[model samples]
Target: MNRELQPLLDEWAREAGVPGASVGILHDGEESLLTTGVSSVDTGQAVEPGTLFMIGSTSKTFTAAAVLALVEDGVLDLDEPVAKYLPELRLADPVARDTITTRHLLTHSAGFLGDVDIASGWGSDALAAAAARFDELPQVFGVGEVFSYSNSGFLLAGRVAEVVSGLGYEDLVRERLLEPLDMTDSWFLPWDVLTRPHAVGHVLRDGKSEVAHDIGLTRSLNPGGGLWSTAADQLRWARFLLTGQAKDAPPLSDATRALWRTPQRAAACPIEQIALGWMVTRHGDAEIVRHGGNVSNLQLSDFITVPAENFAVTVLTNGVGGGVLGPKVVDWCLENLAGLPALEAKPVVPTDPAEYAGSFPTGDLGFEFTVRDGGLWARMVATDGTIETPPAFEVAFVAEDVVARAADTRRPLARFLRDEHGEVSAVEFGLRTAQRERSRLTA
Candidate 1:
């Protein structure tokens, strides 16, 4: 199988133009690791099995797990309001600030602006400082209104754990989570990662690969999307999730695993529901819980697990093209190794395409939907000049209110949200909500 996979991985990486890539798979009590390309184009160092790559938001699982560990230790409750721990918490909406809980944060339904990026300095107080500025974040919806991903909510959740455990977020995770599971290759700091064989993230410039200007995430957002890990280490993390058994890790109660498996909220197709830190999808009777990660537009990762099949796979890459490569690799592994075929989402054309055409703006990111050629077209806009704008592409409704790329419907691109009078009021994209730009709406 390694012999067959090596050439395929090599071909995929070359086609995707990623500088470095690694894959790990665990199936039926056996495991395999595969690597291709150099860790850095400048250094020309071969990617080793243990070379570290940023796992991005995939670290959210670790954050959620660390909080759960606290729950097992009788230090916290998921259902309790976050204000119980951070008494000084403030937000633009008092009701949401007061009612949001760890569960709400875990499930990405905290209702505040999810895309706010607070860059508190590199210190043990970073998460605390980031959570302190919540008053500036606008309320996108009422509490528990819908499923909009919130990195801010996760940062606050970590702050809750920090307050209760009397330890910093990184220290708590290192001591209670990674160290216990024997995941020694994982690190949360730049200095720590520099000491190991690590991959540098890359971006394409004029069709040429260039090192990304900024590769590290802010210390404040560490709880939301900051962790450097190897493919081998990620497989070990998945094993712990599979059986709740690890080298020195404490046992999670049956109820805790049930919470991890239970469907907390309904989501669009391709994602049947959202579980605790995992996206839950159904293929036949198998429950596929998975998550993908992106780091500053430089690195991309995909992690998947099937508990019933006792199978898991992870792909890590040092280039943005991994966005395309990672999913292709996962789908292949699922069908060949786990006998689970990937589901293809068919387009559902709405009766009126104009109903979804408008400008949805949120924070630094926005989307413009226009009616063209009797179909709906969409493109991403950068409102604050913090991001690069991309060209428009054709998209179609895949569900009653969901819009995805017409070329690939495997993942939802956005969901059109309606108001009390059933008028489109906002759009949920990249798991964040953007209110309609009524003044700039295209008729």
Candidate 2:
């Protein structure tokens, strides 16, 4: 372990207004722990490796694994229509229920919207009510057409797990995944574990510290973002993912494991496509599977594993600085401790500076592309050519185009589609949309 990295980690925790932060690294079958900051402003308890934090969407990987276990036991089939298991399931488009399969939900290709509106609270009934709304959502696209991050998709997967296993989603996960893995400190209900000394999330409101409440804990979303876990427990979970060495682990077949890690389709990724609940990318010759979580307040978390490298890293933070702090911390560890090169900040290059500059349309949105500072920047302009309230920027590159950061938290440009001529034909501005040729304008 590099002791010198402690001060740099501490500095980020403080700068991010994190009440607490913990990082776990697994390399060559060994582990390293680092923590800093107080767990809460009120209690003043020092954050430690065992301090629990909301892991948010990273919980989906566990849910997906459990579902795969059932599949291995012949309790379910991935390609079969989801309606076969949950007959009551419905979408505004009746055909979707029949056409979309369990696989679609797992891969987030069902096109369901992310969340359902509900009263802010916790209870079984609230969860049931939210899950019941699945009958009303319109399909945004045909099943398996494109990838869009859909929280409701995973909720439905959880619901299917409940129906097929004859158990609640939380109970099934607890029995099959958590208990077998010995993740005793982790649970779906942090509120129930309130007696334990756990980090209380907070938010800065009007320069006053306010307690952060659980945002989406209804039964429906439990499979999506409801898991709470300590850094130590998360490290255990990370090891399971890195090595697939769970005692009495849910029966995930080798074939199923391969499919889970394989990229399903080219979704709207800024860098790489997504698989099941994991983010898929290549780092040199190794494939990386990772996921990130945000519980909406000052609670953020991320987990990354490189199976080929036998390495994994987890970053959990209690402050909500737009959720970048955790990822940045993880990146730092990968660079410094693991001896990997720092991820190069996206560089702007244009294959053809003139052809790259143009006006393009994305559904109802219009944008103007311009070149500046040896790079490219885009501004969303109204139909009448008025600048949108928040503008977008990008660093143009011939092969790996980089989207510059935007003030309103838009993703930096890191995507491009090539033309038949092998020139940059289309530019993708992060996970949002892609713009193709309009009229080439001079820089």
Candidate 3:
């Protein structure tokens, strides 16, 4: 580990309003741990490498692993219609029941809105309540035609795991995934764990740190982003993700492992491509599998693995800023510690005043890109004509070719493809969903 980077990371924790931050790096098959700040501002305890923090959506890798395990046993089929397993499942659109398949669910192509709260409640009943509400959501688009990051889809997928494995969601993960990987300190607990010796979440209120509220327990979306873990345990999980095997771990087949990292669909994200539960990218010559998580004010986490490089990073924060804070730490470590290049800056071209004007529909998400001050700016308008600017990266030229850049990270815009006539022909935002170009509706 680079000793010089430690103080820099602490500076970031303070700037981001995170109470505590921890990072683990695996390089050349060796591991190093680093931590800074206090775990809880209330208790004044220094953050330790072993402190457990909520890992948010990074937990999806575990859920995806369990689903793949059932696939290996023929207990589940990735391509089968989800309705086959949960006969009671339905969407506001009756056709969606038949059209949405397990594959669609895994890839976020089912068109289900990400409305269900994962941080609602804890325990089996909370999971049941989330599962029972499948019929209420409208299909945002035809199944598999567009990608809308859907937490409900994963929640349903988790239900599928329970139905087939005959184990509760948490237990299935604990026994099948966590236990084998020896992630002994990791587990799903009630939201009150936020009040324990665990790190405290924080939000910057009026430029000062204020303890953030635990945004309730995730009852329905637990499968999507609800697990608390330490930097050490996350390192263990990251190692498994890198090697697809752990010592004394009941081994998964190479095929199953490969399936987990395969890109399923382009997510409706700004930066990386989305696989089933993982994000896939190339950091220089290395194949990187990664994911990040956030749950309002409570917790944030990120996990990244470079399989070919034999390197991995796990970051957890006690407060809300931990979400991006963790990734920043990872980016710093990769560039400084692992000798990876800092993310290359994309070329920025001044938009031609005339060419910069147009209204385009990105499936259900629509925005108008306009020329302003010799630069291109975009404003997303809702059906109600309310205008909002999504993170700047949400606006891009040529759809999929656009990239969104943040202070700590960069995400690619969903790409739009055009036909020879210069008419839009297809649209792909994330790796998961692509819609063919169709005739513009005449009003």
Candidate 4:
């Protein structure tokens, strides 16, 4: 299997301009790990089997899983208002503060601005301190009104875990999830990772891959996306998700595992549904539960699995554009390794592409869509000076009111949302609903 995957990994890493990457696969009751390229452009270090790469939001699954374990232990209830656990917790909106549930947090439907990142401190009170600052985060939509990805929500969930268990979030996860799965190489702190072989993140600037900022994630965000793990450890995690058994770790009951993959709310196109901690989708005849993570344009990671087939694949890359390599590799693995054929989209030229043209703002970044060359194109605009904006890229309607980048239709970029009058009012991009600014601009 490595013979078949190594060449593809090498070729795809080069094509994606990623410095280094590691691929892990669980196939037909066996496992395979393949790696390619240097860990960093400057250091020229080879990526080894145990080299750790930050898993980013993929850590959310473990956070959600830990919350679910607490639920099963009768320590907490999923539907209970989060205010029950953290009575002092406050949001910018009063109602949301009182009514948001742990379930809402797991499904990312808690509905405030989901992108808030606060570095409270390296102390044990980090999670709680960071969450306390959430009063400044304005509510973008009503509680559970729609599916918007919330890193903030997970931090709250982690804090709840900390409070209820009387253990720190990292300790709770290590005891409840990671240790059981035998993911011993995965670490959440920078100090822990720095002592081991780890991959440094890289970013592409002016067509050259350069080493990115190496300071690890803030302690407060660990529950959301701060995991540093190896490909083998990630594959072990995938195996546990696939079969829910670890020789040394207590198993999460079958019922709880099923609930984790159960659809909690409807998401936009490409993503069919949002489960407790997993994104559910159907590609061809297989149901795929997966998640992808990016750390501020530094590292990229993807984890995908087909439960019915007991097949899983994880791709960990060390560069910004490296994420593109994941879908390509997954497509190949599904076809050749898992025997599932690819599903191609047959998109059409919309009659009035102008209807989708407008400026849609979400937090610090926004997108300006325009009609050009008989199609819709979008340029990412920075709403705040902190954001790095990208050039305009063409997109196509893969489904009604949904657009994906023209180059990769399988990855939906934004889904248009209509108000009561049946006109486009906003867009759900990156899982956050961005209200549209009216305009008749054409490029």
How far out, in Å, is residue 120 in model 3? 6.9
For model 3, residues 383-419, the per-residue Cα lDDT tens digits are 2322222333224343233434322124455454556
Each model's lDDT: 0.83, 0.69, 0.69, 0.84
Better of 2 and 4 by TM-score: 4
Clashes of each: 0, 11, 31, 0
Q: After superposition, how far is residue 293 of candidate 1 from its true place, in Å?
A: 0.8
Worst 10 residues of 2 by lDDT: 382-391
lDDT of 2 by residue, 96-168 (tens): 8788887888887886554443333466544455656776675656778766566778888887888898887
Q: Candidate 4: worst 10 consecutive residues by lDDT?
A: 382-391
Q: Against the correct fold, how does model 3 do in TM-score?
A: 0.82
Model 1 lDDT tens row, 1-443: 68877898999999988999999999888899999998999889999998999998988988888888899999899999988888999989888878999999999888888776788888878999899999999988788887877788889888998999999999999998888788999999888989899999887877767776677468888888899999999998888888876887454665786677678898533466888888888665788888878776688899999889989999999997897789888888888889986667776766578878888776656778888878888887767654445457888787888877888886677777889999888877766667787754453
**Model 2 segments beyond 4 Å from truth?**
115-121, 125-128, 206-210, 214-217, 249-251, 349-402, 406-443
User: Over the stretch 359-429, how does candidate 4's per-residue lDDT look in tens digits?
Assistant: 88766667788888888888866576433344578898877887888887766678888999999998877
lDDT of 4 at 265: 85
Segments in model 4 whose C-alpha atoms lie over 4 Å from true places: 214-217, 372-374, 380-390, 438-443
Q: Which candidate should be chosen as best, given lDDT against the real structure?
A: 4
Each candidate structure's TM-score, on Cα atoms with residue i matched to residue i, is 0.92, 0.80, 0.82, 0.95
On TM-score, the leading prediction is 4
Model 2 lDDT, residue 43, Cα = 74
